[model samples]
Target: MSSNTTQMSIVCISEMKNSKRVAVEEEIIGMVKLNPFLYERKHEMYKNKCMRNKKFNELGKKLNVPAQQLKARWRTLKDKFFQEFKAELIPSGSADEAVKSKWKWMERLRFLENIYTPVDNSPCSSLNISKTVQELQQNMTSLVDRAKIIAEPSVPKSAAQLFFESLAKQTEEAELTPAEFCNLQIEILKALKAASIPNYLQMFCLQQI
Candidate 1:
C-alpha cells in the first residue's frame, strides 16, 4: 500500500477499535441495568475495590459467572455508576451547593451509597456511630499519650507544655460546664448511634479522623 493509504488504514483500524470498545461498554451497562444479580455482584466488587481488598476475586466468584468477563466489565460499570452518582449529588443548578461545603472523600462515598446502592443498603450505614466515635476519641487520646512518651527524649519540656496548653485553651473555648460537656458528649454519642454506623466502619472513620 502507498504511504497515504497505509496511514488511512491505521486510522480506520483505530476508529474501529474505539467503536467496538464503546459498543462493549454500552452492552455491559445495559446488562447491569437489566440484571439485578449482576448489579449486586458489581456493587460488591466496587466496594471491595474501594477498600483495596486482597480477595476481590471472591466477589467475582460469588457472581457464578465467567471470571474473565466479570473482571473486564466491573470497572466500566463502576465508572457509569459514579457518573450517575455525581449527577445525583449535584444536579443541574447545584454547582453552588456542592462548593458551599468542603466534603471529605469518604463522606461523599457514604452520601452516594446511602441514597442509592446496587445492593440492598449501604454497608457503612450499619455502624454504631456513638460507640465508634467514643472509641475513636479514646484511641486518639491514647495515641497522643504514646506520642508524648516517644518524643519525651527529643521534645523540650516547654514545647510539651505549650501543646497541652493549647489543648486546654480549646477546652476553655468549648464554653460548657463539666456537667454540660458530659451531657453534650452523651447527646453526640446518641446521635451517632442512631445513625446505624457499624463497628469496623466506626474504627475506619476514627482512623480517618
Candidate 2:
C-alpha cells in the first residue's frame, strides 16, 4: 500500500477501537444504573460485600465481562467523571472549562454526584467531640467538688474567673475556628442548661452577652 493509504488504514483502526471503548463504557453504565446499590452509600448493598459482589456477578453475566472488570470500569469512570465534575463546579466562566469538562463521561456520571461526593460533615460530629465533652464534664465535676470547700480569705479569684482560668489552660494549645468553637459551646451550654444544677460559667457567659 502507498504511505498515504497506510496512514489512512491506521487512522481507521484507531477510530474503530475508540468507538468500541465508548460502546463498552455505555454498556457498563447502563448496567450499573439499574443497580444503584452498587455505588450509593445509603444502600445496604454498598455496605454488604457479599451482596454487592453477587450483584456485580449478575451484571457481568449480562455484559459478558468479569465481575472484577465491571468493578474496575465503575471505579475508573467515576474517578474521571468526578475530576471533571469538580472542575465544572469551580467558580469560572464557561470559557474557562477544560474542553467541555471531558464531556465523554461527565454527562453520563453527573447524576452520581450525590452518591460520589465526599460527605460534608460538621466538625463536632466525630469522636473528638465526645472526648472533648467527656473532658469538659470531668473538669466541671472537679470544680463542683472544689466549690463545696470553704473559701480561704486570700482566695482572690472570683468563681467565674477560676472556672474560665481552667478552661483557658485546658484549651491553651487547641486551635479551633470561631464557628467550630461556637457550635461546641452551644452544644455544651444546651446540655448544661438542661441539667438541674446551674453552672457558674454558663451564668457568667450569659450575663456578659
The per-model lDDT (C-alpha) reads: 0.38, 0.55
lDDT of 2: 0.55
Tens-place lDDT digits, model 2, residues 144-169: 44453324656676564466554544
Query: How much does candidate 2 score in TM-score?
Result: 0.45
Clashes of 1: 8
Model 1 global lDDT (CA atoms, 0 to 1)? 0.38
> Model 2 shows how many backbone clashes?
0
How high is each candidate's TM-score?
A: 0.31, 0.45
